[model samples]
Target: MTRVVFVLLPEVHLLDLAGPAQVFAGADGFGQPYTLDYVAERPQVLSAEGLPLVARTDWPVLGRDDLIMVPGWRGPVLRDGPVLHASAVERLRAHHAAGGTIASVCAGADALGQAGMLDGRRCTTHHQLQDELAARYPRATVVRDVLFTTDDRVVTSAGIASGIDLALHLLAARHGPALAARVARDMVVYARRNGNAPQASAMLRHRSHLDDTVHRVQSLIDTHYAEPLPLSRLAAHAGVSARTLTRLFAKATDGLTPLRYQQALRLERAEHLISQGTTVESAAREVGFEDARMLRRLRR
Candidate 1:
């Protein structure tokens, strides 16, 4: 089983921790088995919301399949949050050095900095602390106004609810976008937050409607985005005629037909593959394009 360990800091922001926690926990409802472990330097950590949280002081053994995360905490100022224990910082470094994935939510990036994980990495945090984080870790590349960033094995989120976006993206990478979308749907999240992805995931982007027909069509498109799908097939799945499916789809997704939405998913996946060093032609083929022609046109 994959282990997800959360390092609880003193006065941790409740949502900062809970958002990602709930995301991972919801994955279990979708048949993804993940063991969650909470570790802290102290036995009782208080939340910014005045809730006391219990954690284990003893660390768990983790490996490459494991994920260790730091949740942001409350502070008077960006530079004034609770300082992480030396041993805790060492644990973060050791985990990453062991090929484990490390992540942070909001101001938790500060703790990762203490672990030296931010050194020469691309990361971000709550906008309020972006300047402070950059000034403190000059070697790190801090991208502003983004939900999350990933470099090497380190992932960081902007703040608060973005943690959910970060966790969902991680789930997509581990499992697949279809599973991640189901997880997001189970949580009532629109799955619209793209984090650093070039385009939003279909699970949430065109999902702001109560039309069951449109939703069914979108669900079909999301799971089979790389396949050639005609409007007639989508309409058949939705139990509607092709013209009605087109009209309802437009009404649901702000004028985007089912075909356009599928293309969006394809383009987004293609861009991600290309960024990971896949050739444009290969990426296009992988995302269902007959050739690079449409991909090139969409990219342009």
Candidate 2:
């Protein structure tokens, strides 16, 4: 079983802890063998939302597969940061040194900074705190306007609801995208959304619409983009005629039809694979194209 440990500091945001906690709980419910534990310097810690939370004063022994997360609290961060016990800070640093993953949400990056994990690593926090995070951790590369970032084993994300996105990413990497998608569906949320969407995921760039029909179709495409999904199949899933589905999709997404949107998703995934050193032909085939020619045309 994988042990997921949350290091709770004073005045933590309820959602920053709850959002990712819910994701792991969902995974465990699906029989993924995740055991979640919470550790804090004190027996009782108050939430930023005014809820009281009780936690364990003793930490569980963590293996390399285990995870440690720091949820953001409400503060100016640079002005008055949450006080982390020096021993707790050492646990954060030691876990990473032993080849484990460390993650943060919003101003939680401040804790990771104090643990000295963000040095020379790419990280991000909420837009309001990104400057403060940068000013405080000048050695770290603080990416702006993106939903989240992962470098080595240190992960950081934007503020608030974006913690869900960061958790979904970890689930995708640890389990698989399919299981992560299932958990997201169960939670009635999408895995990604626009913050500076173009820098995020294809799933985020085109999800700014409110039509349920278009959303249903987009969800289908998001999971099976690498498969042979024809327009008729997608339309049938949306319970609309192909022509009607095309019209609705275009109207919702500023005139990009279902086929075009699928191509965009495929193109985005292909670009990511290619950037990671996959050959154009291999990337094209992996993304469900007949060959590299169409992929080349799309790139141009």
Candidate 3:
């Protein structure tokens, strides 16, 4: 089981804590293995909205697969917010040093910086504080106007609601796009992409449905998007006739054929590989396209 720890700070924004927590919890509800835990410096914490929260001060043993998250807080000014003690900062740094992933939302980036986790890392925060964060942590590369940025196992997000996007991205990367989409659909949200990717995420683009048959087909396609999946094979997996499966898929996903959905997944993955410096031909082959010609045309 993966342990997800949320470190609470004084005046913490309720949404920042609830958004990612709910995402992970919802994933677990869908059969994913995750144990949520909340920790803070004190036995109790207060929210920005003036609500009181009880938290634990005792820490748990975390491993490489575990995650530690910091949610943003409120303050009169960006710099005047609640401050974390040196011990807490050290805890965050030690977790990352031990190969655990550490993430932050909004002003929680400040805590990460104090831990030295943001140094030399590409990260982002609320747009309003981007410049101040950059100036405060000169060694860190602060990206702006983005949902989230992950660098060297450290994840940072923009404002409050972007925390959902960050959590969904993490889930999709760890598991696959299918389960992430399921969790998103369950939460009634669009699984938007992280960073500045203009195209819709394959998870979100194929979502918006209630048919279990289409969902079964989508699960197979999402997990093995790089394989040659025929209509007959998909029909067999869904236990339906090919014609019926086509009609169901079209209706569930807004007129997208099963082949088109697979193509979208392949193209999305290929674009990701190319963006990471892969050659067109290599990306095409890796994504199950026989040649670069078709992939090029799709990209255009």
Candidate 4:
């Protein structure tokens, strides 16, 4: 089981804590084996939304596979922001040194900065706080206009709802895009990609529309992208005629035909296989390409 620990601070934002928490919780419903825990410097931490929350005071026994997440808090400025005392900072450092992943959202990235994890690492926070974070941690490469960034295992996301994107990205990487899609579907979030986008998988990136028939077809393709799926078959799954499915898919996906979308999924998976040292021919076969030539053409 992967244990996800949320370290709370005084005046933590409600959505920043709840958004990613719900994503992981939804993943748990899908049997992802994530065990969630909440911790705080004090036994009771009040949320910025005026809700009092209770949590454990002691840290858990965490392994390298466990995740420690710091959800952002409310502060007009860094000087007045929540602070992680030296002990908590050391714990964050120790966990990362042991190969455990640490993540932050919004002002939570400031806690990571306090731990020196942001130094020389590409990270992001809420858009409103981006400039201050960059100025405060000059050694850190604070990327702007991104939903989130991961350097080594130190992940940071923009505030509020963007935390959901960060968690979904982690889920996609750990499990597969299929399960991640299911989780997103279960959460009723279309997994938006905008000016600030996650390292979105094809399944999530192309699913930002509200067309039910298109989404149904896309869901079927997500699970069976490596198979040879003709327009007739895809159309049947979406309960539409081939011609209409073609038009709707194109309109919903910025003119991408169903075949094109499936090819994008296949190509993305093939790239991942190739990056893992699989030969081009083998990766092509794994992703249902007839030959490496097609894969090479797509790469070009």
Per-structure clash totals for the candidates: 1, 0, 0, 0
Candidate 3 per-residue C-alpha lDDT over 222-276 given as tens digits, one digit per residue, 9 for 90 to 100: 9988899999999999999999999999999889999999999888888777865
By the lDDT metric, which is better: model 2 or model 3?
Answer: 3
- Compared with the true structure, all predictions reach lDDT values of 0.87, 0.87, 0.88, 0.88
Residue pairs with backbone atoms closer than 3 Å in model 4 (clashes)? none
Worst 10 residues of 4 by lDDT: 191-200
Candidate 1 structure, TM-score to reference: 0.67
- What are the per-residue Cα lDDT tens digits for candidate 2 across 1-300? 999898888889999999999999989888897898988989999998899899999989999999999999988654597877898888988899999999999889999999899999999898788888889889999999887888999999887788888888888888887778788899999443423333445577689889999999999999888888889899899899999998899899889988888899999878767755689999999999998999999999
Give the clash count for model 3: 0
- Record all residue pairs in model 3 with backbone atoms less than 3 Å apart, i.e. clashing: none
Candidate 1, overall lDDT? 0.87
Error of 2 at 161 (Å): 0.9
Q: What lDDT is reached at residue 225 by model 1?
A: 96
Regions of model 1 farther than 4 Å from truth: 197-300
lDDT of 2 at 71: 93
- List candidate 3 segments past 4 Å from native: 197-300
